[model samples]
Target: MEISDLERIARDIRRRDIQAVYEAGAGHVGGEMSVIDLLAALYFHVLRIWPDQPKHPDRDRFVLSKGHTACALYVVLAERGFIPEDEISTFLQPYSRLNGHPNCNKVPGVETNTGPLGHGLPVAVGMAKAAKLSSANYHTYVITGDGEMQEGSNWEAIMAAAQFKLDNLTLIIDHNRFQQGASLSETNDVAPFRPKLEAFGWEVTEINGNAMAEIVPALEHRGGRPHCIVAHTNKGHGISFMQDRVDWHHKVPSKEQYELALAELSEAL
Candidate 1:
C-alpha cells in the first residue's frame, strides 16, 4: 500500500482507538496512540498472514509486547479482517474477549498472550528460533514499551536472540518516553538504546514512530543480525492536549475532550 494510504488507515485506527477507550471508560490511551502507526504498518503493509487461517504455518508472526495498547491492535485487526469491526464496541465489557491485554488464544492474529511487562520479547525469540530450527521462511516481530525495557527479562531475551543468531527477528521499542506513572527518564532511563543493542550483537535503526514513511522502510529492511528499531514517538500523539502527558496514559477522556480529539483525528483522516 502507498504511504499515504497507510497514513490514512493509521488515522482511522487512531479514531477508532480513541472511541473505544472513550466508550470503555478505561484504556491505556496514550500508549495506544503512540503505537498505532506501528501496528498499522505491520498488519496492513508488512505482515504476511491469512485472516481466515490465523494459525497458518508459514505466516509471519507479530506480538504486541506492550499489550496495554491492545485497543489499537484490536482496531487494526478489525480493519485487516481478522475480526469483526463491530466487536470493537464491546471492548472492556464484561465477558468481552477484547480485554485490556491481548490473548493469543482468543484473538485471531495475536501470537501469544501479553500484558505483564518484559514477556513478549522472550516469546518472540522462541518463535524466531523455532522458525530457524524448522527451516521456515517466516519472520517474527515484537514491540515493547520503553518503560518495559527496565525489566531484566528483556535484556536476557536480547542476549538469547543474539546468541541464537536469530536474524529473522525484529524488535521495536515504542520509545514514547512515558510509562504508567511517570516519564521513562524519571523512572528507568533506558535512553541511548542503540549502543546497548549494538553491543548485544543486534543492528539498530531509529525512526519517528508516528511517520508512516519511516515506519514502513524500517520494518521492511532485512539484515544478518537481529534488528531493533528504537521508534521515538509521542504519548497521546494525535490529540493536542493529551500529547506527551503521562496522566493520559490510561485516563478516560471527558466528553468535551473526546469531541476535540475526535475532531483532530477526523481531520487527519
Candidate 2:
C-alpha cells in the first residue's frame, strides 16, 4: 500500500484507540498512541498475514511485548480485517473479548497472550528458532517498550537470538522516552540502544517511529543476523496537548480532552 494510505490508517487507528480509551475510562493511551504508527506499518505494510487464516502455519509471527497497549493492536487487527471493527466498542466491558490485553485464542490476529513485561521477545525468539528447526521460511517479529527492556529476561532472549543466528527475527523497541510513571532516563535508562544491540551481534536501525517515510523502510529491512529497530517516538504522539506528558501514560481523557484529540486526529485525515 502507499505510504499516504498507511499514514491515514495510522491516524484512524489512533482516533479509534482514543475513543476506546475514553469510553472504557481506562487504558495506557500514551503508549498506544506512541506505538500505533509502528503497529500500522507492520500490520498494513509489512506483515505476511492472512486475516481469514490467523493460524496459518507458514505465516509470519508478530508479538506485542508491551501488551498494555493492546487496544492499539486491536484497532489495527480490526482494520486489517482480522476481526469485526465494531467489536472495538466492547473494549474493557464485562465478558468482552476485547479486554485490556490481547488474547491469542479470543483474538484472531494475536499470536500469543501477552501482558506481563518481557515475555514476548523470548517467545518470539523461540518462534523464530522453531522455524529454523522446521526449515520453514516464516519470520518472527516482536515489539517491546524501552521501559520493558529493563527486564533481565529480554537480555537473555537477546543473547539467545544472536547465538542462534536467527536472522528471521526482528525486534522493535518503542523508544517513547516515558514509561508508566516517569521518563525512562529517570528510571532505568535504556537509551543508546543501537550500540548495545550491535554489540550483541544484531543489526540495528534508528528511525523516527511516528514518521511513515522512515518507519516502512526500517521495518522492511533484512540482514543475516537478528535485527533491532530503535524507534524514537513521543509518548502521546497524535494528540497535541498529551504529547510527551508522563501523566497521560495511562490517564483517561476527560470529555473535553477526548473531543479535542478526536478533532485533531480527524483533521489530519
Candidate 3:
C-alpha cells in the first residue's frame, strides 16, 4: 500500500479504537493511538501472510508486546481480514474474544498472547530462532512500549537475540515517552535507546513511529544482526486533546470527548 493509503487506514483504525474503547468503557487508548500507524504500516505493507492461512509456515509473525493496546490491534487485524470487522464492536463485552489483551490462540492474526510487558520480544526471539533452526525463511517482528523496556526480560532477550545471531528478528519500540502513571523520564528514563541497543550489538534505526514512510522502511530493512527500530512516537498521535496526555492511558472518554476524538481522527482520513 502507498504511504497515503496506509495513513488513511491508520486514521480509520484510530477511529475504531476510540469507538471500541468508548463502548467497552475501558482501554489503553493512549498507547493504542501511539502504535496504530506502525501497525498499519506492518499489516498493510510489510507483513507477509495470508489472512486465510494465518499459520502458513512461511508467514512473517507479529507480536504486540504492549497488548493492553489490543483494541488497536483488533482493528488492524479486522481491517486486514484476519477476523470479521463487525467482531470489533464486541470488544471487552462478556464472552468476547476481543479481551483487553490479545490471545493468539483465539485471534487468527495474533502470533502470541501478550499483555504483560517484556514477554513479546522473548517470544519473538523464539520465533526467529525456530525459523533459523528449521530454515523456514520467515521473519518475526515485535513491538513494545518504551516504558516496558525496564523489564529485565527484554534485556535478557536482547542479549540472546544478539548472541544467537537472529538477523531475522526485528524489535520496534514504541517510544512514546510515557507509561501508565508517569513519563518514561520520570519512571525509568531509558532514552538514548539507539546507543544502548547498538551497544548490545543490534543495528538501530530511530524514526517517527507514526509516519508511514518511516515505519515501512525501518520494518523492511535487512542487516547482518538483529534489528531494533526505536520509534519515537507520541502517546496519543492523531487526536489533539489526547496527545501526550497521561490521563488517557485507560480513561474512557465522555460522550462529548468521544465526539471530538472521532471528528479529529476522521478528519485525518
Candidate 4:
C-alpha cells in the first residue's frame, strides 16, 4: 500500500477506535490514538505475514507490549483481514474476545497476551531466538510504551537480546510522554531513550512515530545489533483537543466530544 493510503487507514482506525471507546464506555484512548499509525504501518506494509495463515511458522512476529491499546490493534488487524471489521464493535463487551488486552489464543493476529507492560519484549526475544535455532529467517517486532521502560524485566530482556546478537528483533517505543494518571515527568520520566538504548548495545533510530514516511524506514532498518525506534508521538494524535492531554488516558469522551472527534478524524480521510 502507498504511504498516502496508510495515512488514510490510520485516520479510519482512529474513527473506529473512538466509536468503540464510546460504545464500550471505556478504553485507553490516548495511547491508542498515539500508536495507531505505527500499528497501521506494520500490519499494512512492513510485517511479512498472511491473515489466512495466522500461525505460519516462518511468518514475522509482532508483540504489542502496550496491550491496553488493543482496541487500536484490533482496528488495524480488522482492516488487514485478520478478523472481520465489524467485530470491532464487540470490543470490551462481555463474551467478546476483544477485551482491553489482546489474547493470543482467541485473537487470530495476536502473538501473545500482554497487558502488564514488560512481558512482550521477552516473548518477542524468544520468538526471534527460536527462529535462529531452527535456522528460520523471520523478524520479530515489539512495541512498548516509554513509561514501561522503568520495568526491570525489559532491561533483562534487552541484555539477553544483545548478548544473543538478535539483530532480527526490533523494539519500537511509543514515546508519547504520558502514562495512565499523569505526565511522565510527574510520574517517572525515561526520556532521551536513544542514548540510553544505544549504551545498552542496540542501534537506535529516532523518528516522528506518527509520520508514515519516517516510520517504514525505521522498521525496515537491518542493523547488526538489536534495534530500537524511539518514536516521538502525541498522546491523542489525530483528535485536536485530546492531543498530549494526560486526562484522556482512560477517560471517555462526552457525546459532544465524540461527535467532534469523529468530525475531525473524518476530515483526515
- lDDT by residue for model 1 (116-179), tens: 9999999999999999999999999999999999999999999999999999999999999999
Tens-digit lDDT string for candidate 2 (177-261): 9998999999989788999988899999999999999999999999899999999999999899999999999999999999999
List the candidates ranked by lDDT, beginning with the highest.
1, 2, 4, 3
lDDT of each: 0.95, 0.94, 0.93, 0.93
| Pairs in clash, predicted candidate 1 | none
The alpha-carbon deviation from the true structure for residue 251 of candidate 2, after best TM-score superposition, in angstroms, is 0.3
lDDT (0-100) at residue 116 of candidate 4? Answer: 90
In candidate 2, residue 186 scores what lDDT? 98
Model 4, global lDDT: 0.93
Clashes, model 2: 0
Question: What is the per-residue lDDT of model 4 for residues 57-151, given as tens digits with 9 covering 90 to 100?
Answer: 88899999999999999998898999999999999999999999999999999999999989999999999999889999899999999889888
Q: Give stretches of model 3 more than 4 Å off.
A: none
lDDT of 1 at 26: 95
- The TM-score of predicted model 4 comes to 0.98
lDDT of 3 by residue, 1-269 (tens): 78889888889899988999999899999999999999999899998989999999889999999999999999999999999999999999999999999998888988899988899999999999999999898999999999999999999999999999999999999999999989999988888899999999999999999888889989999999999999999998888999999988888899999999998877876
